[model samples]
Target: MDSIRLKIDSRADQVALAGRCIHALSKVVVGERAAFEIELAACEVINNVIEHAYECREGNDILIEWIHRDGELQIDVHDWGRAVPADVLFSPLPDIDHGDVTNLPEGGFGIGLLNALSDRVEYRTDEDEGRNTLSLFRRFDAAGISR
Candidate 1:
């Protein structure tokens, strides 16, 4: 078990860093299913930061950390951007009418996907400092079953 840290800038770099993390973690994960689940969850989270945190600004930086401990993988994403409202952040999934493609929104599904994929999701923010921290954790046993 090890810890990996990355400083990501730019949307492209965020995706690249996520891919690298997934590749590295795959080597230690017990099964393909767990690895893929974590990778997909991370992808959605980082993409949300790129799209909403800094509003696609080019210079903003995101700190990503992955820790493997006690047969669990934990991810922490830190950003210095406008703080998202707690109410909206924890709100239930939006009601999407399948036929309304014209009015369909581009975002809001990342958090939902992350929640479904990860065993645990936590968030913290400091409005004055404009910093947001999101953490996700998933546990895998030696048998490759999620605990």
Candidate 2:
């Protein structure tokens, strides 16, 4: 198994760094396409933590951790900001297919995107601990095709 933990400030500029690091680490364990997918998912989670949880505030702590074993990858993102509403966190994916293209939202689609990109997604918050975690899981075959 391979694992790493990363900590960064809740700032927009730091997102790019996290993306790059995630991509590089994932590429080593999976194919380029799979790595890119993980990178995108991680970025979306981080952005949500910053914008929604931290309200775009800087200097707040965001922690990311990745673990790979048995051709499965698990990524966890933790933040010490506001807890996400259960309704929003567990909502079903938006039905964008039936909507008008122009009427579509430019953002607020991260949850759906994350669900589409990963094999599994989970979100948890502990009020007493003041921590929220978002976890993503993906599996790959020997050929590096995501399953």
Candidate 3:
């Protein structure tokens, strides 16, 4: 199948719309678990871009694309905002404490979840062009092994 691509504003609503498109495609091929994983990862990745890189700025366009090849589904997120520091982009993931409500942090888990849910996660920045692209992937067969 041909890859699907979208160019959306760097706003929460538009980002969510982009994510919904991925969710719809995932649900049809993968099971509910994998579908949700893909959907959540998509949202988290964009949220990080919005919060950190774009600084919640509006009007900027974010590029999102979905491609399925060789039993793998790939999602690419591109942004023209300020380049994120490599340390922040590749930091170690934090642990989640779901059982303890009081100990739960308000944020800081998005990156970890993005890395965990997707089979592979990569970030590349075009220094001269001042652009960044995040690539996420999910591998599945008939049973849909997204996790």
The best candidate in terms of lDDT: 2
Residue 50's C-alpha lDDT in candidate 1?
78
- The better-scoring model by lDDT among 1 and 2 is 2
Off by over 4 Å in 3: 91-93, 96-103
Better of 2 and 3 by lDDT: 2
Clashing pairs in 3: none
Which 10 successive residues of model 1 have the least lDDT summed?
Answer: 85-94
Q: Name the candidate, 1 or 3, with the larger lDDT value.
A: 3
Please, what are the lDDT tens digits per residue for candidate 1 over residues 1-147?
Answer: 678887888575668667567656754664676677777777777777777777888788888888888778888888897666655555445568889998887767767777877888888987777779888889778665775
**lDDT tens readout by residue for model 3, 76-126:** 999988777666755556766789988877777788788778888888998
- Identify the runs in model 2 with alpha carbons over 4 angstroms from their true place: 90-93, 96-101
Which residue pairs clash in candidate 2?
Answer: none
For TM-score, the strongest prediction is 2
Ranking of models by TM-score: 2, 3, 1
Per-residue lDDT value at 96 in model 1: 87
Mark the 10 consecutive residues where model 2 has the least summed lDDT: 90-99
